[model samples]
Target chain A: MFSLQGYGPSILEGTYLTLEISFVSLFVAMLLGICGALAKLSGSPVLRAIAKLYTTVIRGIPDLVMMLLVFFGGQVIVNKVGPLFGYNEYIDINPFVAGASTIGFIFGAYMTETFRGAILAVGRGQLEAGYAYGMTGLQVFSRILLPQMVRHAIPGFGNNWLVLIKTTALVSIIGLDDMVRKAAMAAGATRMPFTFYVAVAINYLLITTVSIYLLKYLETRYSVGVRRE
Target chain B: MDFAIIASNIDIYLEGLKNTLILVSISLIFGLVMAIPLAVLRTSGNLYVQAPIRAFVYFFRGTPLLVQMFLVYYGFGQFEAMRESVLWPLFREAYFCALFTFALNTCAYTTEIIRGSIVATPHGEIEAARAAGMSTFLMLRRIVLPSAFRRALPAYSNEIIFMLHGSSLASVITIIDITGAARIVNSRYYSPWEAFLTAAVFYMAITFTIVFFVRKLEKLWQRHLMPLEQLDTKIEAPSI
Candidate 1:
């Protein structure tokens, strides 16, 4: 009968949890990505090597494996460190923190590539002009490099964002009470798994649809002065 | 940290690797086959044919594969008709459910990648084919598809790797792929680092192998597009 008798509020809460995880993870990802891109671009060999190793290994493995390792393995490490610091009680790792950081770390590798390409796409002449106009290094970066890099980065960023949003669903596997988990619970209780999962699926589609539009709007907003080919 | 656990349990890991490989290869093959027509339809200039396919691709690509797998494996059973249907036996198996979800998920991504390259195929080449008295079918077969595939190779290779990574989700439905193997080891020996890191190493090996072969294939396919001098560096043709 496709009935939803009593699971509406919990499902809404799950949706909020999903959104909160996604946004927090996205912020962390962007921060790591910019740092990674800068490190790879820097002249220091050690920085470049470390960044390269991180991106290569992170990109090579599955995110689910990363999630499992971070959640459980991280707990072991935290507990190990806790007793050493004279705090002997077991420290429970929050699934939210574990899930967000893992997802953030995984996508940071991808975003590094996108940001690197975007940075490289900005012309050297433009940076030189900024320098010639009595601009400091930070001024050159903020004024000349940042805006154009964002424009060039938007397509790849949009792609990464879409994937990142979908990737958040994996957090449920690690026992986060996200929308998918909420749906599973509802499905089990109501014995209408189809309806509940479909509900989750529809919510995801709606979010993605809205994201695509919002990304397009940002693209337009950033592309204000540029002429379209 | 516990290397001994992995060393002692290598066989179980190998079994998991085998399952992962089977799931990835079968799903990739099926997904690729299904994707070709969908890719073509996706780019067709008609709305009716394109609309539904676009919706299908969007729905699949927009949601998580984990959800799709759950919807198929658990959700399908909710319907009385699906349970009573003749195909229920096949659907009941966890392996089939995983395979079906993986195939459908990869098909959506592969379709978009192929469609992008198909649309990107140079218009001038199509014109040349048409001018050479080629029919539409012949043009598509000889020029369009080949050129499209060549252009698509890089992106398609990424999709293959993504699918390989995605195959880990089979563990969620209890199919026991590499990730599942790691989970088992983690639960048993309580050494998460050794268990998942071992599986991670296996994935990295597979990923490197794919990247190596794809790079070689790209170089081979791109020969004609490269300048003659760059094409045969060893020959060192006379300075001209």
Candidate 2:
């Protein structure tokens, strides 16, 4: 009664795709997040203002709405610009690219906040000490600031990651064929949505449960030699 | 680029706005009402009492709300018994399914938030309440719940905005919330920007409003934690 009906391989492939989208988007989000954190923390007011606006607008809008806007609006913009470039045939944006990038872009705002707070949590004296030892600006950042910030950023980063994983489910709406979409298709064919969705839910639970343990291990690893009250 | 499409569809957007607001508000109310008891039970010492609630919270919080909504809307229909049950009528409607999923989702998060705050309630406060000769129920009612609610406010506010945003999923299931309206306009005129940008604006306005009110409530509730000079200064006469 609880069989996968020969869709086990398909669901496993979908799960792999889900994780691929997650890691790719995580990489994008982290890149944007670091740049954004630096921008916000920079001495320049214009950089700070741009960072502020990016975080505010992105966080205020829903992820699904942002995905729709970027996916469809982006297609229109690309095709319109294609004509001017003398390539006027229709061009469709890949759902995988659109979905990953939109999730990354939306979560980048969140990652900015997380990274900014993490950076601030590092002591001013530590950076001063690094400079006092004659370290280059890049040296101080990589050797001093980045290491300590990981400990502070882990909790918020983990939270963002879990939410991002869930947000990937929305990509199925735009036809990305993630596990949620795969489950939907399987359910449609089998006429047993309860079995299929429950399977999908269990898959998500496994991923999240594994993530929680890994995050805890990282937190402890990074907290070595630091005193905890 | 087509302002005319958006201008012509303003009423549809407003109707969608109404549905979105209704969905969010109702679910929030139900979630909070349900969460309070579950949270209390979650904090209990008995393993039996806490275990079931823990599993409920874990399942709801672990999975995506979209999946939960689908599990309710589509999954339930798979069972012949559920189809024959009296609850089938309510479960059949997309609005009900969305509300059921959202309320359970928010309730899980809310329970966790309230649990954290409850656990963090100052030991001194609990000792003081005990020294006052209050019963456990009385102490909880008078001391623990109030302070926990205050402490939970900031996190709870985030959950509220999340629920508001999550309500957009209702459109996926055929409910004409703001996103649903945008989807319609986009499909009708094939103009994504006008349709979605308007939806984004509506959502941003609501988000800001929620933030604004939560800030005000925090100020009012956390007034005692404020400095003496800041207290009651609003009643003072304006400087000449």
Candidate 3:
């Protein structure tokens, strides 16, 4: 019999926070990813160079380092900048905002690659065809390119998401009350770290497994009307 | 911005770099050795034989490395039996605990990578080995594993970089890796940018080095796939 020792509610709350951070970061990542992808694909040399730099640096550095750099460094920068303004008081960055943004910024690089490849996979002729029909660039993108890119993007997007969910664990190190941190607190109180850590791991497994199923369903949905071997 | 703190703390960073290199190298070596056999078993047709290995891979890949590291470092000590066991001494040390956890985690990912390559080995090669009167074991040794290893190199290199990055987690349990060094420097000088940015630079250096070497290895191993003119040029360059 595994017992939470009166810590069940707290663990549940941590799990909720973890999910919240993951989804918020996912949203930010997707937004940046699209912009980065377009910039990379764009004809402007400067935009391409900036996007290239973003992906290269982010991918090269570890996520934890980025998180710490953003969290602690951002706090320092904000406080330093505060005195320049009318507000002179020391301002602390919220852990939630810092954690989510850091994760998003880091994963944005990965998502950029995924989206770039997916957009390229949608073929150039289709967009040209849309143009031939007198469609605007936005219309070609939304009506033709976006729909076709989804199927190609899903596999890479799904992989990024799984990694992103796991990356949320790093947020706990930044003093966020995610399930891992909650588990740590409970383990410290009860001296049953094995039980609590295993419990947290199982919760992660459940989320990932469900996400895999949903991704598979989405893949199938998007592939509808397309022939498969 | 504070170069003075970083300059003063270079020795500490070097010591942390040494620990990080030791951790990443040992785990990667052991992980690769463990993965080969596991990968072969994973590619087996028997459901019973495959299921256990599948589950092992699933569990490792499905969970976060931080949790796994904590489980090995702190969770094991929670059990009375583990405490009294001979392994307790090793588990008690953060270094060994991190090495053990990282090796297992990398082993799982490497197994899946190797398994994919193994399964993708051309059927013609296997048939030729059979046609030459080779036994299954001999064929696997001579034909399958070599090609699989070659194909697996690119993916395995990525895993190595990942392991190097993951080794930073050892700092959380007090192992004083590069990240740990940065944390100490940050706390001592209250210079987060100087400390962590230096750590980030070190990590980026290692990552680029790995990428460079892997690219070289790929070029070497995949030479046969090059076009005839390029291969001829490569061969004749030294003689000329």
Candidate 4:
């Protein structure tokens, strides 16, 4: 009989933490992504420049480096900044918060590109048609643009989501008690590195398989009423 | 902010950069070589050939590289049979282990990039090649591969950059790559900003260089295709 023994519960708990961090990061990434896309599409040159720099820089660096820089380097910045605000005390960042925000920030750059492409994929004529009907800008966006954009965005969005979920594993490096770290501990203790890591790999595969199904469902849902070749 | 620390540790960083470049270059070259055949097998008409390739691709793509690296480097060491094997000597070195892992991981991604473009190879061209009495080998060599490779350049460039970034993981296993150097400096001086930001700048420099060359390569290859203006607007999402 195979058993994770007492470590099974901890691994399960780690799985929950991983999921929590991923979903929260996804939400935050979407927010930053949408704003970034808007900024890139906006008329102001400064906004466009900022968005461009953000995406380029994020894309250029590794996520592990970014996570380290943010968690440790960011803590230093905060502690330094805090003293100026009269707090005068060292502050420690929660690994969950750091992990979520860094993951969110990195993926936000990817999402910015995804959303921007999706926005562009929506036909220009649709916006002009809304304007012809005397629809306000906001009205045009909400009524005409969003629904169509969602359909185009789904494929790219799905890809990002898969990558983002896998990226959550990097949080383990920053000392987050995620599944990978838990597996490492169990592997070290039991001297069965292959067994534990294989389990973690299977867990990832299960997440990916479920995600592929859900994404296909989303694609179909958004593709409703559109005639296909 | 602390230029003095950076100035003093510049040699250490440079030494680490040498290792990073070595790791990335060796792995990337080997990875690309391995990926092409895997890609051909992946897009093959024969189900038996494609199935195993698909499984390999899925396994590598699904699992995190950190775990893969760990499994190869640390996990293998736990077994007495592994230690007794002839391959044990190679796996014993962290550098070789990291290189092997990185190469294998990038191979999976590159295979998909190449396979997608190979599958998208225009039907008419193949038909024309057939009509001209070109053999399967000639058709693949002269027509399909060139165009598929050209199309895969942009995506492949992203893969190259990704591998460059991924080489940083070598640091985790105690190899003194750029990130490893940063970690050492940070530990010594307690200056995270100076340490990591310097590594970030070095990575950015390499990224920009790759982007520049890829752009040139695209221009050369895509001369008869879409105009530069149109190509500029085709924003691609960041891929894994």
- Model 3 C-alpha lDDT per residue in residues A1-229, reported as the tens digit of each score: 2888999999999999999999999999999999999999999999999999999898678889889999999999999888888788779899999999999998899899999999999879999999999999899989999999999999999999999999999999999999999999999999899889999999999999999999999999999979988
lDDT of 3 by residue, B154-236 (tens): 88998998898899899899989999999999999989999999999999999999999999998899999878786674544
The value of fnat for model 2 is 0.81
Better of 2 and 4 by DockQ: 2
DockQ ranking, best first: 1, 2, 3, 4
Per-residue error for B173 in candidate 2, Å, reads 0.5
lDDT of 4 at A179: 94
lDDT of 1 by residue, B1-240 (tens): 768899999998999999999999999999999998899888875999999889989889989999999999998998889989999999999999999999999999999989998899888998999999999778878999898999999889999999999999999989889999999999999999999999999999999999999999998999888888777658556898
Model 1 lDDT at residue B154:
89
Clashing pairs in 2: none
- What are the lDDT scores of the predictions, listed in order? 0.92, 0.95, 0.94, 0.91
TM-score of candidate 4 on Cα atoms, chains taken together: 0.94
Misplaced by over 4 Å in model 4 are A129-136, B226-240
TM-scores of the first chain across all predictions? 0.97, 0.97, 0.98, 0.95
Clashes per candidate, residues 3 or more apart or on different chains: 0, 0, 0, 0
> In DockQ terms, which candidate is top?
1
CAPRI band of model 3? high
Q: Enumerate the candidates' DockQ scores in order.
A: 0.90, 0.90, 0.85, 0.67
Q: What is the lDDT of residue B150 in candidate 1?
A: 95
Off by over 4 Å in 3: B232-240
i-RMS for every candidate: 0.5, 0.5, 0.6, 0.9
Q: Stretches of candidate 2 above 4 Å error?
A: B232-240
